[model samples]
Target: MIKKAPVGEIPFAIAGDSRIYVTAFVNGSDSLRFLVDTGASSIVLNTNSPKLKGLIHNGELADNLGTSGENSVEYSNDNSVKVGTIQYDKAGCAHIPYPPEYWDGVFGLNGLAAFNIEINYDDFKIYCYPKETLTVEDSYVSLPFTYKYDVPFVHLHIKLNGTLHNLLLEVDTGSDRIIDLNTPFVNKNNLLETKKPFAISRIASSDGGSGELKNVFFDEVIVGPYIMPKVAGAFSTLIFGMQSKENIDGMIGNNFLKRFNMLIDFNADKLYLQPNNFYYTPFYDFLVR
Candidate 1:
């Protein structure tokens, strides 16, 4: 089902051992080996990284725990961060958790959000263009959702026997599978009607925290022009705070994204969903490998 969505690949490079790193730029200056994390709300760095010592302002001790479950008091402040050809001046920054073994820091939406992002998994390269200036020559559609830090999320509003329910979902690029729900939507829906619950396991985040997984078999889940039927997700009532809103329902992750071609315009705050043939052909062959 995911294969039917638009897909592409790029020849992206990853650095570091434990933490895969990528390159970045700030004000056109070279900055290297930044962690690429779609799950993080903002860019962050280790206090010991050469990049953070002098560039950060108003640095303060802050407590942070990510999907990895590593707890640490890292610095939270503002700074200019660069990765490859992209840079963000006065971007938000936080501390890298734990002893900081592998990565210098993470390159998150706080910086990437400034530009239109085009990730070509087929080519393994990421392109950053001015979001405010780009125009779509191609015809596309946009799904409705509330965005926090430029990430698109949907609220699962389900109905059963005249009763209605709702849950917020984050569309995640970093997640490997689909249907990560916090509050097992089916469990509630089942209570209204007699049906066997789909068996699911506990799903873990990149940070290593686990949540109750529930299979959501929806008549139709719509985003843009694409619709997913009987999609599976995790019930994540406990991890709602991981997203901008608590009581969040679930997250749409790679399992869904890999299905379609995607265009994200950060500066303009627009997202365009196009057919796979138009955007994914160049790198589609590679993705199959």
Candidate 2:
């Protein structure tokens, strides 16, 4: 008989704009708030945090790039890192620049990959289960996904004008926008020729790099059995060096994902979606004027 591992649930605080934050303990002493980001590949701590004193510095610099810009991070290892009742010994961590005022660090895929995680947007809680014991309900829509550089990518179909085209989209909870499409995909599909009006906006990366983007609204986007209509998105011609290796078309961000309670099974390569209370909530176009 297979042994059953204990499941754990951790409550998270939601930002006004839908960012999720959870409290974690480092070395069993300092309690810090960390943003749960599926888009990030590793656990990232703020260099300025007092908890850094408890970690053993590895002396190697790790480089990370985001829409904000590139940052050189310091590598470290902790004896014990705990989230609720689950704990990881000798956990690897990277000390990067301090995040925004609301967050001190990021709980990333490096630590999260060990278990199946469910982000319950409706209840502001995270359910975690060992890979062997987790199971999905019949009500959930299960979609197959692939990971590139530790980031999850899912297939989605968008109707442009009258034609439906399948595209690969990254599941990026760290991104606040609804969707961001690369210029190559837009040009190839002649998306600019659509009748929908677009607005020019400035897009910024985590490292403060800025670029211009054309924001537009799509009438229909299909993900499994769900149809998301009147979705807002942006098209960017600027390509980051890190993205060159990724064979993806766009990214699906929090503005669209917050509508559902999501279960990401990295081991099984599946993404499970269950629409929540926010399913019908109006899309907020904070990035566009």
Clashing pairs in 2: 67-205, 67-206, 68-205, 68-206, 68-207, 68-208, 69-207
The lDDT values for all models are: 0.51, 0.73
- TM-score of every candidate relative to the true structure: 0.62, 0.86
Off by over 4 Å in 1: 1-21, 24-35, 46-58, 62-73, 76-80, 88-91, 98-104, 148-151, 154-168, 184-209, 215-220, 237-240, 243-247, 275-289
Q: What is the lDDT of residue 86 in candidate 1?
A: 47
Residue range 209-232, candidate 2, lDDT tens digits: 666667787768886788987677
- Model 1, 114-199: lDDT tens digits are 66666554444666655453566545664445675345665555433344456566656555555554444434444414323355
Worst 10 residues of 2 by lDDT: 237-246
